[model samples]
Each structure stands twice: as structure tokens, then as C-alpha cells.
Target: RQIRSRFIDEVDSGVVRTETGATITQKADRFSLDESSSPKKSTSATSIEYDWETPVSGKTYKSASGSTIEYDLQDGDDPFQVGVIVEHAKFGPGKIISRTGLGMDAKVVVFFKSRGQKKLMLKAAPLQVIG
Candidate 1:
């Protein structure tokens, strides 16, 4: 006895083979080969803006009420504790709402009067305690 084989192409399916008394089926490639279907590039540059304000380190300024405010960067005091009133040149007066971590890796969150809330480093933050 002799066996014959042939290939069959279906619209919905992939390659099919028929050999004498047996049939085999395969799935077609689902990916596209055309370059026109590729993604397009934008003509304009993408713009990104940050909402957080950067405080100047070791800077001093006078408040609107005629009081001189200065940030002592070298002060070896843990003034960034919670519930402490701190003043910044850019964010004005703010209260330390929360403190996280410890030592050099510590961070504090301050709720300012006009600048909302800001997260700053504890040791290097530009903040001065208001008595």
C-alpha cells in the first residue's frame, strides 16, 4: 500500500495536512507583518511638571510680620520632631505632621499654611524651629 500527503490552507485556521487516512491541524501566526500598522511618534516634545517645591538650603528671610527667620543647617538639634512649628523661606510656616526613619535616613512631613504638605529630609531640610 502507498500513502499520499497534501497541504490545505483555511481562511480561519492555519496549515492543515492530510496523509492517506490521517489529518493534522496547526494554528496560524497571530502577529502582523506590515510596517504601516506600527506605532507613530509625536511631533512635539513631552512636558513634565513637578508639584513639589524645592526649599533653599541654609537660607534666611523675614516674614510678613517683621520677624527674622533663618534656617540653621549646622544646628545639632533634633528639631524635626512631630508637632514642631518650623518656618521655611519658600513654604512659610508649617507644622511637622509626621516623622519617619531615624538618624541620617530620617524624613519628616510638614503641613504648611500656604504650600499644602511637603516631605523633606530631617537632617538636611531647610527649616527653622519657631521657638
Candidate 2:
């Protein structure tokens, strides 16, 4: 006596096998296939929002009547210029004492009242008018 083996492909069910004159069927799992299709990923959107207003020069920095912003602080060693007023969403209101960059791409070394002197990049566009 001789035994034969064969494999069969099932479209809806899965696969079928034949060994030693015996037939066996396998069922397909829907969840196992779908689990890999869905992926967990982080959203690429800005969560913080900022408001703009006129600055009162020597007045105390506050959220109201001024611009509010936030920074990722993810790029380079630092960003910001010293001796120049800058808008740091993370450090709030401050001035830049030095700058670092070549031509069009320069960052500021700002001295914030809250965070002291630190480096932060300057985002283009004016948020408020400071006297």
C-alpha cells in the first residue's frame, strides 16, 4: 500500500490538506489578518493655539492683550537672537542678545524673563505690536 499527500488552496475557508488518504480542512481567521492592517500612529497636528495683541512696552507680560505661542524646540542646539524682542511660545516674551546663522537661516539667542537667557528659533511673522 502507498500513501499520497497533496495541498489544496481554499478561497474563503483557507487551505485543505490530504495525507494518507485522509482529508483535512483549515479555517481562516479574520481578526488575525486585520490586526496587522491597523497601525498605531501619532497625529501630525499642532495642539497649542496662540493669540495676538498689542504689547505695552514695559508692562508685565501676560497672556491677555498679547501673543501666545508654543515651540517644539526640536531642531539644532538652539534658536533665537539676543538683544532683540522675540516671541517664544515656550518662554513667553523675551529679547534676543545674539544670533547664529548664515544669511536667511539665523536663530536667536533670547533672554526671556521667565526662562532667563536661552537660544530659540524665531518664527516668521509679527504677532503683536510692542511699544
Index of the highest-lDDT prediction: 1
lDDT of each: 0.58, 0.41
TM-score of each: 0.40, 0.30
The residue ranges of model 2 lying beyond 4 angstroms of the native Cα positions read 1-82, 123-131
| lDDT measured at residue 119 in model 2 versus the true structure, 0 to 100 | 55
For model 1, the superposed segments whose C-alpha errors exceed 4 Å read: 1-77
The pairs that clash in candidate 1 are: none
Tens-digit lDDT string for candidate 2 (25-70)? 3434321122221132211235332222222222222233355434
Please provide, for model 1 over 75-120, each residue's C-alpha lDDT reduced to its tens digit, 9 standing for 90 to 100. Answer: 3455677999999767999999999874435788999989899998
